[model samples]
Target: MNPLNLPFDSDAMLEGLRPWIECESPTWDAGAVSRMMALAARDLADAGAEVETIPGTGGFGDSLRASFPHPDRGRPGILVSGHMDTVHPVGTLEKLPFRVEDRLAYGPGIMDMKGGNYVMLEAMRQILRAGLQTPLPVTFLFTPDEEVGTPATRGLIEDAARGQRAVLVPEPASADGGAVIGRYAIARFELLTEGRPSHAGWALKDGRSAIAAMARKILEIEAMTTEDCTFSVGVIHAGQWVNCVSSECRAEVLSMAKTQADLDRGVAAMEALQGEADGVAFTVTRGVTRPVWEPGPGTMQLYDLAKGLAADIGFQLGCGSAGGGSDGNFTGAMGVPTLDSIGVRGKGLHTLTEHIEIDSLAERARLAAGLLMNIR
Candidate 1:
């Protein structure tokens, strides 16, 4: 069933991936993420690819662009996109160390992305060892801020994707080992509430609580969720001292919609919430956003190619849309064919229990190698 006949050992692959998992490259820690990017850059350069490290801006980590040499190196070719940053903060390894239990491999950022990114690298290494060149040149773009909607690297991702033949994202595969052909629109908002602070015991009636006002607004925003759109306030901060009425409170809000129109309406509703609440001043500031990407003919065709490759590797690859947008959203929205979530299959992304099915490493690497060798 193996079309490429490339030798792959799951155990060896996991061993190679262990270092990546151990390196905690959280999005907010620029130095930590840069170290991770440096590791990747070394591997890419050693693999005979021309690597370029693009420094990060806005307090983010550096990005990498690696291009493989081909007769048509300058022509349109395949672009592989992935993120080096993760949601897990540093020191997570102390509690969630990289370990293998039965068929699952556990670690911070393993299943969500490091596992998939490693698999792609292995695929490329195998292809090179086999002394074969792909039909088209391959380029790898690893960014450092995808976990936070790529606040600093969106332009780099889009610029690299433009004029490319196709884009492939190695985000964790779907629950059923499927690939993503479309993604929903996503919007982020920052909410702030400021109120008059007073001594809790001395001026209980006169004091206005910012936390209370923020809590009410959070409930109101979450209640706006519908089948077509969803909303959640994930982060909140308020009240430095317990004895005093809170003077300021802030929260981060996230909204996802199946369509751009629905997201527009949601944004309008969120922005309209900026007003006075019982002497508390409330404001909503819009943040980064990902546009909706619906499957087009080119995307379907790319998926079809991947499906055939998966079948040759002894699996049926299904295609569907997904939430939690990836870099594919940018390329897909730009009318370039994109296939996402073609990485290792696993569960519990962004949690302490995050892990990947150990067996999916070799299996998915074969699929990735096939795509690299056959895609024209």
Candidate 2:
């Protein structure tokens, strides 16, 4: 079934998508995420999907699995994977409320993912409404924690992808409307500095300021950025009183590498970092990591299929490696054919100006629906 022949009203899709964007499911807010999951569950159930709710662990919100029945239900089939979390906080709605301006639908998480999720759901609904079924069984996995990395759901994502025919990730499309065939390796680090505190007014020379040491370390870390790898310090906290030298400081670091070898060297360098001055102690703790996923023949084949489908729908779809990581990293690294970032076309992700091209509502949905019907 060619989904393009079916009626897809962009305005109606925008309205259907408004509630999802308005829900505000930030990763840190478990209750808000749960509410968003509930909304999705209801929609999937209404569309004739067998929905399963996985209780969240480690204080994250619940994940969801919605399956569409087919003759090949028991076999490995398509996995439509994405996240329900956003980086924006709870009160962001007051600042960036849902609105359509000049053919762009603006809201927190609208372009990053909610728009893509809604489009996929609408595609499924349209297929079912037309009395059609995909060649293979379809399963949708919605995760609750992705903005801070999939620390809570990595195992679940891998388990779901195991033995699947393919994994499709509807992360935000690239700036030029390209899909992701490969993703860079990513590692997170937590740094801490400890020093001796003394009165800033009288005993300044006796004080060893942790903040000063951390500032130097931050510069050193950022200076490590090269063509192969990049480092950034995104968070920092220190000092409690103005009259006393800081005794402790902490920061979060993120590093991205084009290859595993480069990332390994970067990790080793980070672990070997030392304090900038005497009497200050520095420490680095490794956190979540995403292994690099280089495009394989299987992934290339999937991209070829998607590219052809896009051409039939009157758009030229491009494919390449992207910087940020997604659940596709797990599946693609495991050698499963994976396609990432086949979502809405838009810009300003992770900011108050986040939004999607209103016209992409129908265009991308057609692309998604085509993949569902054509992928065996």
What local lDDT does model 2 show for residue 234? 97
TM-score of 2: 0.98
Off by over 4 Å in 2: none
Candidate 1 pairs with clashing backbones? none
Clashing pairs in 2: none
Worst 10 residues of 2 by lDDT: 1-10
Tens-digit per-residue lDDT, 1-376, candidate 2: 4666778888999998899999999999999999999999999999889999999998999999999878888689999999999999999999999988999989999998999988889888899999898988899999999888799999999988999888999998898899999999989999999999999999999999999999999999999999899999999999989999999999999999999999999999999995445999999999999999999998998999999999999999999998888888889999999999999999999998998999998999999999988888
**Which 10 consecutive residues of model 1 have the lowest summed lDDT?**
1-10
